[model samples]
Target: MHFEQANRATGRLVTTGEVGASGASDSELTTGRFDGQDGHGGEDGHGGKGGQGGQGGQDGRGDQPWFELWNVQQGLWLQHQLGESRADSNLPLWQHLHETLDLAAFRKAVSFLVDRHQALRLSFQDTADGPRQRVLPVHDLDVPLVDLTGLADPEAEVDRLIRIESATPFDDLGSPPVRVKIYRLASDHHCVFVNVHHIIADGTSMGILLRELLLCHRAFAAGEEPPLAPLPKTFEAFVQDRQQWLSGTQSKSMETYWLDQLAAPLPRLRIGDYEAPADDVVNETLEFWVEADITEGLGALAKELHVTLHILLLSAFVVALRDISSDDDIVVCVPFFGRDTKDLDGMVGNFVNPLSVRMKMSGSDAFDDVVRRARSASIGSYANSRYPFTRLLEQVDAEARPGRNPVFSSAFQFTRFLPPAKQTSQLDLCLYGRPDGERIKLRFNYNSRRLAESEIREVQSCFQAVLRRILGDAAISLDSLSEPLRQARRTMRAAPRDGRRLGRLRGSRSTTPDA
Candidate 1:
């Protein structure tokens, strides 16, 4: 049976898969010879101006195609080259299928997906104009199938494969940014590993790719041609649109707003302080889930406050940071998926823009008042979110700080779209979620060099405490609540092993607030 679910962002019912259809069997899907080189010029049919032909300027290589880089892409590319230490941008999407699968149909489905999305076929090349993306023509990209079914330790081998794949950097100058591999543990169990560079895809792009890939797989397995929709806009078209928008009046106004908003010296969260300089900085994440009940309460509270759930959570986070840092000014880097236009919704590429949100919190303010302040700040930031972070930095004349990001040291994001996982007729497919679960996944990506894991945990605990207290009584003064809450915790611990106190303890423990 085909299952349909409403896309949280778009509210459109998306078809997960179709039950059965007849045309050609899975084995027959791969019968045709795939001539890797036989494809049309890279830019023939896509929207926007077709791909530029000749390489120009001293920076361009004669053999590679060149296209302009978006501001965010340029920033990331420069950081990858100039930063003393590099964090690998290669991201792996791993899935374990618990049923016997036809490799032929799977490969065909992946090829179909690659052909459909223009961004998947792109690589970056350094040019006189900075880094430019080059799009490759459709080819029979190889999906390596490794058989580990006979290995002495299959589990260890699986881990080894994952480690190697995750650590391997993508050859952005030469090869396409995506790699695929399949490992067979037994006739009925297999694991699929797909690694792609962050430059070419984001979480939303991955979801789009997985959904279409699964649809194609089911169609091919059931002896029918895949019924996937043509992309509404090409990645190149989106890039062109973005460039035009950035040069327009609206972008200038937005840029001005950011310059003023961030004019004050950026406030650093009191998570930790690392003075020594490190060549490379690696980020560590703390993963946790907010239970359905608390999540529901948050949603209700968001409605009552006339703000988004994200805004409410961010308000509590600001209060928590204030409590820890004792600094009234708190700035957080919040990620915005820069897909405001409907045309760019399904197109794959790096569309994430991290914008700084500055919120002023006072200990004496009421919880509701702080939430309103956060809401206003959030609304203003989001209204002008399309301005590129790199351009904003230049506009503000902000100097890069040693061992830290310039404007904001901390980041926050709440994602509703988890990784796509589904079951088909012959395969029990499972695409790994962010932290792998149904409840909202809150990932706190922090600089390991600056902030200790213990400090992050403390921040998490403080956020939870503040959120619960506010929910219990939104009218409470922020200053009065903190001490009383500490005292309440002490009283609860001292009261006894009675049911009432035990219930209170359970409530306290359940509030695993997102960072």
Candidate 2:
């Protein structure tokens, strides 16, 4: 099988392959003399030339504008324990890379994906009739993987590379119908990464791209040109489809839901006791992990309750708010994969939709009943999630509430992505010396003004305790979740808050924590 990767340091395509089965161990190949600027003529049989530029459409009208989906998570960014390295070199994982190496086949697959999904290859056009979408055609995207080997300090080099990428900024403003980046990292091995701004592809589409790229690379490795499937419809078709849907009754219902949710303006969190300059805003992150067993227990509880994992998590979040904010009503931000269609899976684009989940924590509401409410609200939001969050914010005339973010504050995410399978032959594949840091995969930004690490942890601990209780007693209602939070408040009264700055809240009393 053959695999094609973009070499960032040297903007060139590098191809590598091996004669092996579906799952073979990767053995390192000896490096010959590094003479040629273009990585070619290697004994391991890895080399490729850049393809011709794709023909842009006639009359500037043919090329579509660029678009991006932004999930602005609010609150204090969750910080991690830095500089603590663990030695876990997860190597020798292999996938069908032979087919994904061919440039032609890769482009064909990308086009197929974009043509079938609106979230991929969508552009916003400023026309006389206001901003509109001018969907562009998907062209060949050649990602060159560089081998950043023998660096004095590879981590420094990687950080330098990331800074350079950030400088160019993804051009979310105008032009460059797509934001493309060639990233370099040394995770258990030196490797190059690519993040095709969702304006061009989504997470699921990435899966499609990888699968097709493998097929294409395999065919190329075997010295045979493979024919790829044609796309059924262009992104424009999706735009047209969405417009029709928006003008219908569904749009009205979505607008109504959003308006009602925000009727009570969001409350701003009071930052930590420390005072800041007039124009400065304080930002902080607190990160903690829930072990594998805990995750499994949560999943099991969800299964037993016949509710989605999302609902269970949401209920926990509500309980947290009750403990920390002393508020009965709470709103948490939830991100949804906007690609509801099966055919859009392989398309690369941004389709993240944010939904505001508002729930009322009543004295008598049972835990099971709260889960049911959150679940129903979440599923219903998905049905009309196509409404861009920016649009919804504007329609509701809601001002950005003070705090970390203008709109939403809290976020929830669950990831299950395994690393890319590696080839057995070292000559065909290379592993980095260090492991990849997976802690920052999903981040939450919170306001230190109102909530501190202590408060957040106390709330989280309460939720954990409540979840454990529910695991033992499935019939226990939502009111029962309060015991832990109540216990937390009692403990806090005796223990000093960690970062008690000058102007911070000495403490606030809410409904007494009841058993």
For all predicted structures, in order, the TM-scores are 0.74, 0.62
For model 1, the superposed segments whose C-alpha errors exceed 4 Å read 1-65, 82-87, 152-156, 274-282, 285-299, 397-399, 417-444, 482-515
Error of 1 at 330 (Å): 1.1
Evaluate model 1: give its TM-score.
Answer: 0.74
What does candidate 2 score on TM? 0.62
Q: Residue 181 lDDT in model 1?
A: 88
- Look at candidate 2 and tell me the lDDT of residue 248: 64
Candidate 2 residue-wise lDDT, 56-128, digit = tens: 1111224445322232210000100121110011011112121123344444544443333434444544457
How accurate locally is residue 289 in candidate 2, as Cα lDDT from 0 to 100?
Answer: 52
Q: After superposition, how far is residue 348 of candidate 2 from its true place, in Å?
A: 2.1
